[model samples]
Target: MIGAALLVFGLTLVLLLSIHAAEARHPQADFAAPLSYREAQAVVVAAQAREAHLRTVVSQPLGSVNPELLPRMQTIYFPQTGHHLSNRSGFLDFWRANGQLQSFGYPLTEEIVEHGRIVQYFERARFELHAEYIGTPQQVQLGLLGREILEKQGVPPRLDEAQREGRYFPETGHTLWGRFRSFWERRDGMQLYGMPLSEVVEEDGRSVQYFERAKFIYFPEELPAVFRSLQHSYGYPLNALYEVQLSDLGRLLAEQRGINLAPVPQLEGTHTWHPALWERRVEISIGEQWLSAYEGDLLVFRAPVATGRDGFNTPVGDYAVYYKTPMQTMSGCMAGECWNVPHVPWAQYIVGGVALHGTYWHNNHGTGIRPSHGCINLRLEDAQWLYEWTSLGTPVKVRY
Candidate 1:
């Protein structure tokens, strides 16, 4: 009986030791077991909860007019941050590849049509989709935000040593060749023109360069007679001289930014107009530097005027006041002569970009110095009077 009892105790002890050995091998609950359906579902739901943090962008229609032209929906993914964005179409990829993710950030809104062109706004940049340039190299382009910003600040980018000596600015990607290199250097490079704001843009069949204070155009094919002769005699490149004319861009630029650099003087009250004011007419003599405003041949106002100088001669023709603004910003440049006058008050655009406006820069209106680029310059009060008196479509005759 004692032997049998001892045998039973030894077997029990061995069983206890085996159980301890198995527990030591595992040390914890067995995780290798296949999860049940409920457990698997919980795991999946947790993963989805994490992914739900990614932003989902939605694209809205620019308008009902061109639904067929709308871009198909697309989602963008940033693997590094595990952030997702949608509705950017190819712009997201383009932005990523072009290093605009940090500079421009994400899209503020879906693509929309602006000024008859498809455009998308980002934080620091505006992406213009030139559908008209489909299949061309310019299908996508950046707006002149940098230029507009610089013009607003009245401070442009600084130039490097090469740019100071009149070379293409490295900041402009070197596409804007030093077309006005010598001219810009000779005519006060930094203090006068600021830096080149834009690359050479083809507008109205001519290449144009926008400077902070001026605009220069390229007329390579048709050089003016004087410049043509200079090209023949002195081997001067007319391509860089006569063909390149100064353009008036201040008012237009200001309009684009929706901020007036020059505010018009507000009249105390609306002035009563004379019945004859409806028949107001203006006459300018380029050679005499004179302007005369008349009502039915009865002189209403006469003022000494400054016309365009030499190469920037005022156009001699018949025109009418198509548009009149209270204030305008005038800017132009060509060769060695350039002018960027901001906040010009009392402007009446006669034809093209030429206007009769107040001139605060110089007091020599009646003087023989025809310092104006093309527009006629008047004294402050005279221009204000004319601006108030003149009517749109008023006939203007500019001669000699």
Candidate 2:
């Protein structure tokens, strides 16, 4: 009788140990970032280990009899938690119709009736249904729950409607339109800008619009055909095009906002560059008085510069940084008079004798002051930075 009892105890102990080993090998499952198809499979597998009968049920396709769970709606069941969540009917349809995962994430709570409206919660969004069908596309709308919730938690709220709509530009008396309008819309209109803070105006001779998040300047010359349409739409006269085309308004606007939107690039800890690297180019905006370096489509560096004086217009066209010198003496002549500049630094020759170089001669690099003799002049430090960042044969584009 004693031996039989001991044998039973040993068998029970072995069974418990085996169960613990199995649990250690296959742990409980939870989604970290989000549930992908493969991740959902792993979660199901873990659940099956916990309940053998669940294997047969999991093998069957995840189906829903609910009419709302159609089109893009997907029903997901979590065996670990024994809870099911779904993108069903109204809220799911609204989310897909609007922005889906881009605007709002998957649902967190089931649809609940609140204040005579159906509501649901998502990771980053909240949805509410209205029968009146007054605003947005569908009867469903995104609640400003995030803003309200944050404000209750002592966080600052976003700008109000008055602040967002922005004032008009007193100089031009224009509003946003054309390429500027298109770019703004594409970049997420109200979400980014809230509203135009001011009317379209000229800060320092450039067409500009101030928004809550950013400032946009119009460059008509960059796209002439498009500008023609813009000019026609805005009813701008032919005479004003030249003045609007050449101004340092973007840089000045950025400075007023206290932001460095034109970020410089660094090559340290990067991969190698080849023949196509020289294909990178630089652009000098005569109106904005700004020079921008680009690697392919990416803007890498930007700085202020002084271009050629009145009569000696810095020829605007395509050129290349063909030659470079750390220090040199630049000499030129106009009619009967001759002039010489000595100890110039970081010279990168562009066209003929004209070059982009560092000027210790003056401190008015980006002050909209023109003091150079037909050469693009930079502050000493800016010149040095450009010298190190650029290479021979880099294309140069000078635009008005």
Off by over 4 Å in 2: 1-279
Top of the candidates by TM-score: 2
Q: What TM-score quantifies how close candidate 2 is to the native fold?
A: 0.33
lDDT of 2 by residue, 1-400 (tens): 7997687557534533433343233221110112333342344334323333333344333444344543344444333223223444355445433434434444444555656777655544556676687454556655544234323333322222332233334443334555555545533555533344445555456666554433455665643353345446545322111222212222333244353333223212221222132235789999989998765455556778988767666667665555578777766556354667666667886555567887655667678888766788886556766787666545577888
Q: lDDT by residue for model 1 over 1-400, one digit each (tens)?
A: 7997687557534433433343233222101112332343343334323322221111122234254543354443333322233333345434543333323454444455768876655544566666777665456665665466555654423333343333566664432455565445533435344567765566677776666545667666643354345546644343322344455343344346554233222122111122231245789987788888775545656677888776656667655555567765566555655556556667776544567887656666778788766678886555765777666546677888
**Where does the lowest 10-residue lDDT sum fall in candidate 1?**
53-62
- TM-scores for all candidates: the values are 0.32, 0.33
- Count backbone clashes in candidate 1: 1
* lDDT score, candidate 2, position 57: 41
